[model samples]
Target: MSAILSPRPLIKENDVKATLLSPDFLRVSQPKTFRHSIDVYLKDSNATGNIYFARHFEWQGICRERWFFECVSADMLQSLGVFITKEAQQKYVSETFAFQKIDCEVNTFGVKHCSFSLLFRFFVGGELVAVGHQQIVFANKEKKIARLPDHILAKIREYEVEKGE
Candidate 1:
């Protein structure tokens, strides 16, 4: 298949910008996350019996939310306003069917005062099915950007796990 019709090759280049699809992106050396298990349901599938392309992005957002909830309290989260997805990149490694229990592992990257990046790897049966990445920034309902709260930043540091560990 041609590159246009198939998943594009992710080249490891010197000038390639960091995105979820980058070769430098994170994934656990081991297959199992042993955390939350996300179910792949019919709602997540397309007419062709495969997961819709956009569902990967949705699952990415879900995983991000789950991680944030772990990092802060519900009341504090409400005060934090919306977390704008500044950028996203995804690569579908293979097809995953409905009814599979997906294991997702979240990794933190590029942590800054107002923004950070997350890499989510989706796996089934110890095989990678997809990888999604997002660059997230703090913003209010008005979309006004703000510096990341110290509490959140501190948790993100504690949240990250070394890939090979």
Candidate 2:
């Protein structure tokens, strides 16, 4: 007889966020968030009818592009040169079944000389399913790392302050 393996479900009552907080008051603030929805298609599912692991990255890309076009202008992006992905990380809290609608919320949490970070959270039916973080760096037309343009940075700062972040 052959053994079949199935994905394990995340157990409740173990709130990951609670374990990481410090007792001392840390001045933490939420970023301005952008929300987008992804409708899972058959092509995005695996044999088990759950969304394929790699599809999460694809959805994240969609969310990121939507955010860029909405919050900033495509022409502005072109004028500023290119933004390249530096690093990406994700933590899957639960599985998403096929045909489900996943709500993705994204926000910029950190910015620096030539790079910025976007945090993404995926939820299914109001339950947190995954969290992702991506770092992107500005680059020149020659593909060399470059400092973010002041105008763009100023716009981002204005948006952040407007959102009370």
Candidate 3:
């Protein structure tokens, strides 16, 4: 168990949970989600022979960084200081067996001054198995929270689906 960081925001935040936790995308995939994947192995399973629940968190992290590598810029990330997941929530839908490939669709939501949300949907054989939501923020070397840099925002916006889509 690790300490969690949340509730702290650089400025007054607005209502963003509806967008971040919406299940609409599960029904119809978002058009611009950055997709990433993982092939589950025995090592990823528990004694019950199902994937260890924590592995979803690992997948969420892997997919998030992969999005940064493929869509966002690493150099830009380096410019921002440290990254922290202010909050993370997940819903386990069905049992996932070993050897099944999991496709994690990543999309940005609720962008704000110094934090934003990411929605992660895990699908196997085109069926939703799990859902995850994470809110992330960055801080400077002095431990000051950093706002979303314009270039990074633009890159994220490119992957954002229009409202009501």
Give the per-residue lDDT of model 3 (tens digit) for 1-165. 897777786444454555555687347644478988799999999877799999999999999889888888866477657668999999999989899999988888877768777888999999999988888887786778987678877787666653332
Clashes of each: 0, 0, 0
Model 3 RMSD, rounded to 1 decimal: 16.3
Which candidate model has the greater TM-score, 1 or 2? 2
Give, for candidate 1, the lowest lDDT window spanning 10 residues: 27-36
What are the runs in model 1 whose C-alpha is more than 4 Å off?
Answer: 1-34, 140-142, 161-165
lDDT of 1 by residue, 87-107 (tens): 999999999888888888787
**Once superposed on the true structure, which residue ranges of model 3 sit more than 4 Å away at CA?**
1-31, 161-165
* Candidate 2 deviant stretches above 4 angstroms: 1-30, 158-165
Candidate rank order under TM-score? 3, 2, 1
What is each predicted model's overall lDDT from 0 to 1? Answer: 0.74, 0.78, 0.82
lDDT for 50 (candidate 1): 85
TM-scores of the models, in the order given: 0.69, 0.74, 0.76
Q: Flag the better candidate by lDDT, 2 or 3.
A: 3
Position 1, candidate 2: lDDT: 100
lDDT of 2 by residue, 47-144 (tens): 88988888889888998888888875666487658989889888899999889999998777577778787788899999999988788888988898
